[model samples]
Target chain A: MGEAIVVTSGKGGVGKTTTSANVGTALALLGKKVCMVDTDIGLRNLDVVMGLENRIIYDLIDVAEGRCRLNQALVKDKRFDELYMLPAAQTKDKNDISPEQVRKIIEDLKPDFDYVIIDCPAGIEQGFRNAIAGADQAIVVTTPENAAVRDADRVIGLLEKTQIAPPKLVINRIRPSMLRNGDMLEVDDICQVLAIDLIGIVPDDEVVIKAANQGEPTVMNPNSRAAIAYRNVARRILGETVPLMHLDEKSGVFRRVRKFLGMG
Target chain B: MNGKSSITIKGVKEGLVFLLDDQCDFVTLLDELHAKLDKHEQQLAGPLVHVYVKLGARQLDEEDKERIRAIIRKQGNFLVQTIESDPVAEEAADYASYRLHTVAAMVRSGQTLEHDGHLLLLGDVNPGGTVRCTGDIYIMGALRGTAHAGCAGHEEAIIAASLMKPTQLRIADIISRPPDEWASAEPWMEYAYLADGAMQMDKLTHLHHSRNKVLQAKGV
Candidate 1:
């Protein structure tokens, strides 16, 4: 059975949605039959980021309410051979679906997919609990900002409250130049504060916004450094030990994409 | 006044107000309304003006309102603005809709909050979320989403947010822009309204209901 991993960040706007889309797309690109679920009802972006919003006939609510079968709500992503997404209902509130209902929905999804990465909404509310309810694993996305780190710690405590596996951390939008200039917080500082295992450190790239505006995930962008990092995170999720991307001040990102993809 | 007059049409500062007689048969009321507007069709042609239908205490069938709308359209280029019931019935409607929904959580993208009357939100309305209400909307947190107040075409409706940076806001029949104009106005709770075919944003504390007594109200 495919393991369900939830991408959550207690803090808002720290790249949880972006990480979910990229990491889930990377997993699917690695020949896994992957399904990405948007548990962030009301404020959903997985389908829009994946460029599959128009294909959604039924949604998570439809499946939970038995208005449609589970497969009927899964929108197939033609970007890859084995990728699909379960979109959240745009017109519904977060409280409309309970955690128990989500658990049952994921239970039905687990049989057909290899990796079910759920894109969770922000905050530690009903939507957050519902997103984490069905996951076998959790990936907490955060930035090096102190507020984000504090929220990530709180989220980690909440995950432990539910007795799931130790949550992994992905420090997104890392600005190495800023860190070197002593303007931004370092990855080690965030890791020390949050006290979680590091999964991925994504660099701040303008291409992410550009790709998102085009309705494409950054993982598919061969030229993006964040894409390479996301693919490495996907490998780590698959139990592959990959070194973190070294942020060099001189060579920067000129010669990394070829070297990153050549290894796979 | 015509002997069979059941529809009273009068000009006001806002536009035109029509009072539908409560005792008249629905069909006769509609017939008189159509005839009166058709007689003045030439005078009511190009410029679209607001039209309010006052139905005292009687609640007509919803389809009856639609038929009235069709008759108005067939006669002139008037926009049916609001259909207000009697004061007692309005009080009862308010009581029926007194369950003011409050979402004590952050509203995220693809989510929408809809209520019949006033909607009170204690969380941030993030981008991609939408909050709509037929009455006034009060957001205790930042409103970065799309908010449509007075969605049922009540011109007197207002939207107030603690930190107002909405993507778009609508009050009554007017849609507002200039979200960036008030980026510095977030710290102050802001409300929106429509004046002279354009949206006006002001501090919530200064929001005044522009209502008058029935006769003076009729002049407006």
Candidate 2:
């Protein structure tokens, strides 16, 4: 049976859709047939990130409402032969479809794909519920900020109610300089707050923004740090042991020496 | 007044209220009522069954009421509702009536565990999670959330945990110190209680050193 994984972050702009796009792409590159489902109805962005926005003819709502066949709504990605995406509807309200409807659509697509990645919407509302309805696993993305971590804590708490066994954590947009200067939360701090297993640590990279603007996920580029980190995340999901990305290695020996001394 | 006063029934717009006689033999009257209810079971069966089974109109304490509620639930067709006349008065009356609720699962963030009596959590309470109780709070695992030990104004209630690093801690009314820096180490078991109207926390070792004093205060 294919596994459905939901990439979610309770706080907005914390790289949920980004993670979903990259992870799904990486899985497809790993030779597994993957499908990316955007459950962020009413505020869709996954299609654009994957550079498949213009190719969308029918969306998830269309398939759920029986307006289109399940395979008819799946937009194939040009980059990978095995990769597909089901875009969310931008014209309807989030409440138009229920979690059961989303689950049914994913169930219909499960047998044909090896992995299904759902790009969840922000907040723990109806949209979030729909994204997680058919998910066998969850990846909670959060930043080092206190507010974002607090929301991540809440989202993890909610995910516990559904018994998503040991959901992994992804800390995104982390600045190593800030951590070295003792100005921001470290990975350990976030783990202490949210007692979850660490899966991915994406650094603050301008390449990701550039790729997003060009309607491409950074994971498509092998040279991008974020792309490498996401590939590591995809590997971890496949039960591989990958060490955490070294996020504190900045330029300059003076800063490195200072960091060594400040490691109290 | 009828001599047979073991049971009196009154009709309300919503449903019915049955007042049991306190002077009669309790078990006998209960069995009799249970037998009486069995005869009319089909007539009362419905999606909604609302009724009041007051142990004593105004004198029954919280435990008694709870026991009566349990009995009503055990009956054929009745949804027991304990009508509280005054929240304050009933709370005051229920001050000494407490229960020890044991939950064997980790309390996650965004989730809340609220109880009218003592709460014993078998797992860690993560950050951003809140565990509120009217009486004492005990956590078998780590404590990293907001915990209100005496949520119902019971200052004597205490909170104890194996690892007590809370984001926020409250004893009765006072909010304790802010969450401490995240330490990636196994902290010793800690306990939180009130002393001189202020919250005080101590490691289990120190509390064990002053066992007489700590025990005296703990029983308060």
The TM-score leader among the candidates is: 2
Runs off by more than 4 Å, candidate 2: A250-264, B1-104, B115-122, B177-190, B208-220
lDDT of 1 by residue, A10-40 (tens): 9999998899999989998899999999988
TM-score of each: 0.53, 0.74
Which residue pairs overlap in candidate 2's backbone?
none
The candidate that wins on DockQ is: 2
Task: Give the i-RMS of model 2 in Å.
Answer: 1.8
Error of 1 at A141 (Å): 0.4
Clashing pairs in 1: A42-B109, A42-B110, A42-B111, A43-B108, A43-B109, A44-B109
What DockQ does predicted model 2 obtain? 0.47
- Give model 2's docking category: acceptable
Tens digit of lDDT per residue, candidate 2, span A81-119?
999999999999789999999999888888999999989
The global C-alpha lDDT for each of the candidates, from Candidate 1 onward, is 0.82, 0.82
